[model samples]
Target chain A: MLELKEGVRHPVDFILNGKPARGLAEPRMLLSDFLRQELGCAEIHVGCEHGVCGACTVLIDGIPARSCLTLAVQTAGRTVETVRSLAAEDGALSDLQEAFRRHHALQCGYCTPGILMSAEQFLRERADPSEQEVREMLSGHICRCTGYVGIVEAILETARSRAGAR
Target chain B: MKPKPFTYLRPADINEALQALARIGEDARILAGGQSLLPMMNFRLAQARALIDISRLAPLAYIRKTAGEIEIGAATTQAQLLAWPQLGDATPLLSAALPHVGHFQTRSRGTVCGSIAHSDPASELPLCLATLEGKVVLRSSKGERVLPAAEFQTGMLATARRPDEVVVAVRFPERKQGAGYAFMEMAQRHGDFAICAVAAVVSGKTTRLGVGGVADKPTVREWSGLPNGELDDALNDFAWELGGTDDHHATAAYRRELVRRLGRRAIEEAAKCSS
Candidate 1:
């Protein structure tokens, strides 16, 4: 067993958005704090720290999970993709992000990054999702602004556009 | 909210994990998915001195089928079970209930056995396990013991698990060929904890009903060859027997009423589907 003592920060190395990222964290450190405070990942927001809020959602090994509910040590050798990775290498907004902009899907933008991450993962698995299905996925997130009407429309429109492009 | 400082132990395999648990004793908790445990730790509801990390134990992540039941390992995530090709056909009740366990994000990492280990009254897996009369496998360096659902879950947020033991696996009975199954719940939001949840299993001349979120633990009652009117009376009595307590999410009377109404709906639906 690899034992990490209490109150001592241990080295944690993982892939961040396809790049190697390393940090030192206590065993009690949550992945949310480790990303933002330890590794300078400011794009990951911390809402309800108990996993009720989706502000800390990120893709670990391509599966969406609440970073706040995950321990930093658990991601030692895993790949973690934050919302910041949604943009292209050239820093251009992804199609889903553009769709959110055109449809006015967000305001204040606190929950947008998490929503976009979930939307990207959702759209990747589903080429043509119904409005209700998109809404079901959005239920994971809590966006006080926009009331989800615009968010739903944007996701649906993105599905339509992506289908057309194919 | 941050968790209290705790020692983290990453065991390479199950043997090492059990050894670590045996050594650490009561102050240690087996960290499987950490979806529920981590949340509780963050809220300071549970403060473990050490966490034996078994989430990375490759040998523990499995869903195995036996002659008459499906065995889920400690590290098998909810998403993996939901994505299992045979899940719907083999255990329709689990298929119906898994979606309501949590949102997609949480389910991706939340383990099946971990939920049972958590023993949350509002959780879906425990209710399903109880409705199916599932068995929990508690393992330690000493030995292994299997406990039925009713005995495994002792009280709210509690189980019969010893401090030195880990919930290695849980076995759920496969759906009988002719039995009908149905699960239903009423929650404030799609992914929020259930105000009341019900599961029903109906075979010829017998019906098993399990109720959760209204009691300290998920409880199941069986009725055989009851007519509709008599079944209504029985459900009313069962609802009262549950002693539904008033919480911020709902009132005791409201919960009892749900048991009567939603419980009836679930039973009727299962009855209809029964061959």
Candidate 2:
């Protein structure tokens, strides 16, 4: 068993929710585990443990990555954001989150965090991507419950609402 | 589900990375983008005592045009390469094949060098590299050496890279003025590992075809010129040469058919460019 000590001298620094975090973790500690266990962000779930399931998705430097397959230490000096941080300061859902809720994008809700993070990144990069683009971008994520229709509708609605707002 | 514990070293530079690999010896693995290695680790397909994360070596993460070659640092991400305008000119086969590698998310984290190093028979990068006759730069504490793409790949998930060496970069010769390139692959699902992929580069009147996923390593076939009905014959010959065993994704015979169909299409496309 590898012992965990306070600040045991591993250089791992990354910005989380506009705050800088530094820690020392075992080389094998996954970013998902580090975020959940060390950083106490339990919303980042571990679905497949492999990269196939995107339940552990997070934005690394504004691009979505599978946290389960990413080492915690490798995120040093980078920006790591989870869906938990996407909400407003008053605990209100963002426009996309509201759209997901209105569209009923979640049934079991197990895959919601990952899906939300992925959708957030996708919308950020491409505001008005087509349905096919959305489908292609979300292929890396697996959602057994929602069947993806509601999710797709939610993303499209968000895009429309955002376009109208602009 | 968590990976087995291992020592981690994030080298500041390529020299330091090579030194760490030498010190850790066989127990160490170079971490480029963690797209493949990390997943393999979680699946317990690979176990290492030390991981030398090379992502921080920015000098090894670029796409540049040099004298007569297009150079890409080993750490250059697939997404970055796809966005490179010169890639369409220098190696359009790679640009055409990049979108099929995986989803947008995977491409963001997957590096070209890592893909080449992993050398999965079904991967797109290896086929493109081999077809383009790309060169890989490898560095060790002892010295540096360059290996042609043909010599770099040895087998499925294997390469000529020594345990003590780190791949620094790859270079592709500039395409000739009259060269045309085409790439095609079939997968059950988009972004999935290819069932069979073919890349071809035609210059003047000659053509070089490279096929992947049908053999242990990428196979390249060369033709003097576009002979009448020769494209079909070459496809058949390539299929016969592959002779791979059936697996879950596709049967050997089905893959052979794909090779024939896709090969003919790629050649026709290349011919259009020449004309």
DockQ of 1: 0.89
Q: Which candidate is the best by lDDT?
A: 1
Name the regions of candidate 1 deviating beyond 4 angstroms.
Answer: none
Question: Model 1 chain A — which ten-residue stretch has the worst lDDT?
Answer: A111-120
Tens digits of lDDT, candidate 2, A1-166: 1222223446578999778987667778888888888888889888988788788888998888889879887787899888878789999999888888988888888888988988998887787989998888878888887888989999999988888888
Best by DockQ: 1
Clashing pairs in 2: A13-A77
TM-score (chain B) for candidate 2 is 0.97
**Per-residue lDDT for B136-247 in model 2, tens only?**
9998999999999989999989999998988888887777677888888988777888899999877777888888999998889988866757778878988999877799
> What's the lDDT for candidate 1?
0.93
Q: Give the Å error, residue A24, model 1.
A: 1.2
lDDT of 1 at A101: 94
